[model samples]
Target: MINKDSVESAYCFLHQKYRVYEFSNSETQRDDIEFAIASYVNDMNKELYAHLAKGRKEFLCNHTTFAADMQEAINELELRL
Candidate 1:
């Protein structure tokens, strides 16, 4: 089974690293930070899918909906920016 705790921990670590940039009150800086976070999350998803077992991969594809939900959230956030 997939370890939710480990996944959450990894996500927290990544967020702490890339999502903690200081806001500089500049549109360009905000865009840069958003892009960086998006890139990091995309890379992380790629790595996760690569390492998952076949059954888990299938579970992600057919059972869980986090991928679509996350993409929708990202698109919404981008639109707001």
Candidate 2:
């Protein structure tokens, strides 16, 4: 289940760090950043999300995570968009 508190916490953090992101070229910047560090991001943004939907994150370095961590990341991404 998605933990509101954890998600909120990440949202708060991203808000604090990326306050101007939305006003800035947020989406483009995100794409550029991913482009620069494609290996790190798994290149799973809109550009590749279409083709790489399956194993979209395969390029990302594998790491362990609790469900809460995944939810928190999803929340942050959604909130940013």
Candidate 3:
């Protein structure tokens, strides 16, 4: 079973990562951040993957969905846990 600490940790880690990429001004930094996010997402579980995928798709298309997505995921996860 997924624990609260684990969920929070995952959320925090991804949140920081995306926030950094989101505000990045350098193309090289963005590329590196994207690579890092992709690598982390690739190893995530189904629950986390679903949230990240949704966020990533919307972010790519409109650039303003990942934060909300992550927030929603954490809220849901915390409540469920």
Best by lDDT: 3
RMSD of 1: 10.8
* Backbone clashes under 3 angstroms, per model: 0, 0, 0
Model 2 CA deviation exceeding 4 Å by range: 20-81
Please provide, for model 2 over 1-81, each residue's C-alpha lDDT reduced to its tens digit, 9 standing for 90 to 100: 334554454345444333443345666764443343334234234433332224435332223322233344445456634
Q: Write the per-residue lDDT of candidate 3 for residues 1-81, one digit (tens) a residue.
A: 455566676677666766786688987886676566556655556565565456454432233454455455555655645
Candidate 1 — which pairs collide? none
As for TM-score, the candidate ahead, 1 or 2, is 1
Model 3 lDDT on a 0 to 1 scale: 0.58
- Candidate 2, 62: how far from true, in Å? 15
Ranking by lDDT: 3, 1, 2
Residues 1-80 of candidate 1 have per-residue lDDT tens digits of: 32455456435543443344333566576455555545544545444434432234432223144334334433433333
Give the Å error, residue 1, model 2. Answer: 1.9
Error of 1 at 69 (Å): 10
The candidate 2 region of ten consecutive residues with least summed lDDT is: 58-67
